[model samples]
Target: MSVMTISEALHEALRGEMLRDPKVFTIGEECGFDGLYGVSTDLEKEFGDKRVIATPISEAGFVGMSVGAAMRGMRPVAELMYIDFIGVCMDQIINQAAKMCYMTGGQVSVPMVLRLPMGSGRRNAGQHSQNLESLLTHIPGLKIVAPITPCDAKGMLTAAIRDDDPVVMLEHKLCYNIRGEVPDGDYTVPFGKAAVRREGTDVTLIGWSRQVLNALEAAEILEKEGISAEVVDIRSLVPLDFDTIAASVSKTGRAVVAQECVNRGGYGGEISAQISENLFGALKAPVVRIGAKNIVPPFAHTLEDAFFPNTADIAAAVRKMMREEGSACG
Candidate 1:
């Protein structure tokens, strides 16, 4: 086993997949040189121009190309530097890549991966930073994976690359630096499986990507406050692991869903609703959510901090729920 940052793990996975499959290719802006975040650095050199095709600043064209390639018996990884830019290529993603398999009656499959950096932090502001995984997941036939730890980042990316369908892999910008232990050899973590990052008995806190780190921090604080809070990292969103979430909520009788996206219509809302519907009678407290305020991410650091959900907000939500139950609290 070796410890690595999430970014490094992702890079390693991409490299491994490229070496394993001759048909596997990656194409996107800035990938040929150093990649946007260095995720594809040295990849072009290793794989050559034929496999690592760099394109113009045209998300639609390249995404369409990926779809075409997949139909022609090739697996492609298309990188969109920032997920906020996915709107530029919505037609190809929603109309072509996502619908091809079902629309063709299983005659064709789009074996492709859309890799993008998402979430707010580093003061990138409104245009550059947005948590739009919910938007992608809203569509049909697209598998979404929001990995939190280095291990999941490596495993899930490998899984997405090998999947028979198109997969939207959303990497949290803030999680790039977060370090964790990962196996040195090749491994594929199954999509739709949720990992219990930290287990407790009072409240279940669910998160993915960068928010998983925040959830872990909140769990530590909750422990100090004498509240046993279970933190679950929902690595996959589209094929969500509702079983793990329901089990955790059943044991704790409370749920707190957290995410970097804004509160309104965000993925957290869907997750909370699922818990409420499936485990309504088991819940001692209403399912609450911790999310960014519904507004464009602010440019200023101070304002951004206010707009984003943090450990303090998560801890407060858990405490309030525990209080309603008359559970022992600090």
Candidate 2:
């Protein structure tokens, strides 16, 4: 085991994959040295330019080029810098890369990982900070993975690189420097498996990415108020682990889903609806959802705090569910 930040762990993971397979290569804007996070800084020194290629300021062109490379049997990990720019290359992702295998009768596979830095809390304002994972989930054939820790970032990136599909890896902009224990060797964390960070019988708190950390933090705060909240991290949004979610909701009889995106048309609605549809009988209260406001993220820390959901918001939601559960019982 090695203690490292999420950035270092990603660097190590990419290096390991590049060493294992010659087909694995990376491309992004200024990813080396002074790149956004320096995740591939030292990688170029080891692998040279052909493998660690950098591109011009063209999301559409580079993303399309990566999709083409993937179709030609090369594994490409293309970094899009920010998730807010997903619109710049939506057609390439949605029409070409995502549907290539199905469109070609399984003859061609788009094995690519798009590293997207997302979510607010860094004062990046509306243009730079947005949790757009909900949009990608609506589209079929695209696998989305959001890792929370250094270990998870490394393992899931490994799996995403190996998968024969177009994978969107959403990296929360605030999680880059988070330190955690990561394995020094090679490993892969399979998709669709939800990790239960806490066990409780009062309510289930479901989230992913940085929101999951808020869930865990809220769990601790709730515990102080005699509320036992269980935290479930839906690591892979596309291949959802509803079985685990269902079981947890069944055991708790209440649920609170959180998302960093706005509440309106957010992805949390899907999880909340599933609980209502499948476990309606077991539910003691309506599934509560906590998320950012519908307005754009503000640059001010105070306004951004108000716009995005946090530990306090999550705890309040769980408390409301507990009260509602009591009322339903009565």
Candidate 3:
């Protein structure tokens, strides 16, 4: 095991995968030597221009090109500087890359990974700080994986790169500097597997990416308040681990789904609805959802703080769920 930041772990994973597989290559903006946020740092020097290719500031062009490369047998890891800019390449991502395999009747597979740096807390303003994972998650052919820790960051990246279909790996910008223990060598955390971060019986808190950290902190706060909160990290949104969530909700009886995205039309709604449908009888109260405000992320620090869901928001949601009187079964 090695203690490393999420950035370092992701860099190592990219390097290891490129070294292991000749087909694996990376193409993105400002990803040559310095890399954006240091996730792809020094990769260009090691792999040279062909493998560590850098593209111009055209998201649509580069993403489309990467899709073609993927269809032609190269496993390209295309980095979108910020997930907010996905609108620029929506055609390529939604129509081409995501639909190629299904459109071709499984004759051709788009084995590519789109790395998106997402979330708020960095005060990157409205355009750069949006958590747009829900948009991609709604698409049918794309597999979405959001890692909250260094271990999952590395493992899931490796898994996404090797996946036969198009995978969208959402990297929370706030998680870049956070340090955690990661394995020394190659490993993969299978998709649809939710990690139980904390054990409790009073309520279940479901979160992904950086929101998982907030959920963990909320769990600690709830612990002190005589409420046991079970925290579950839904690592992959596309291949969601409904079983794990259902099991946890069954044990806890109450649930709160949290995310950094806005509350309306957010991925949390999907999870909460699924819990209601599958485990309604097991629930003691309705599933609560905590997320950012519907407005664009604010540039001001205080507004930004209030915009995104935090530990306080999660704790409050859990408390509210616990305070509910009638059981869902009743």
Per-residue CA lDDT of model 2 for 1-330, tens digit only, reads 999999888888888999999999998877554358768977888888888888887899989999999999899999978899889899999999989999899999999999999989789998999999999999999999999999999999999999999999999989999999998798999999989988998889999999999999989988998988889998999899999999999999888999998899999999999999999999888899898999988999999989999999999877777776678778
Find the 10 residues in a row with the least total lDDT in model 2.
29-38
Candidate 3: RMSD over Cα atoms?
1.7
Instruction: Write the residue-wise lDDT of candidate 1 on 1-330 in tens digits.
Output: 999988889999999999999989999987898686778879888879988888889888898899899999999999998998898899999999999999999999999999989888779999888898888879999999988888888999999999999999998777788889999999999998899988899889999887888888988988887888899998899899999998999999989999889889899999999888889999888999888898999999999999999989999998887786676433
Candidate 3 lDDT over residue span 79-127, tens digit each: 9889999999999999999899988999999999999998887889989
Give the number of the best model, judged by lDDT.
2
- TM-score of every candidate: 0.97, 0.98, 0.97
Off by over 4 Å in 2: 328-330
Candidate 1 residue 12 C-alpha distance from true site, Å: 1.2
Better of 1 and 2 by TM-score: 2
Give the Cα-based TM-score of candidate 2 against the true structure: 0.98
Write the candidate numbers in order of decreasing TM-score: 2, 3, 1
The C-alpha stretches of model 1 lying farther than 4 A from their native spots are 327-330
Q: Which residue pairs show backbone clashes in model 1?
A: none
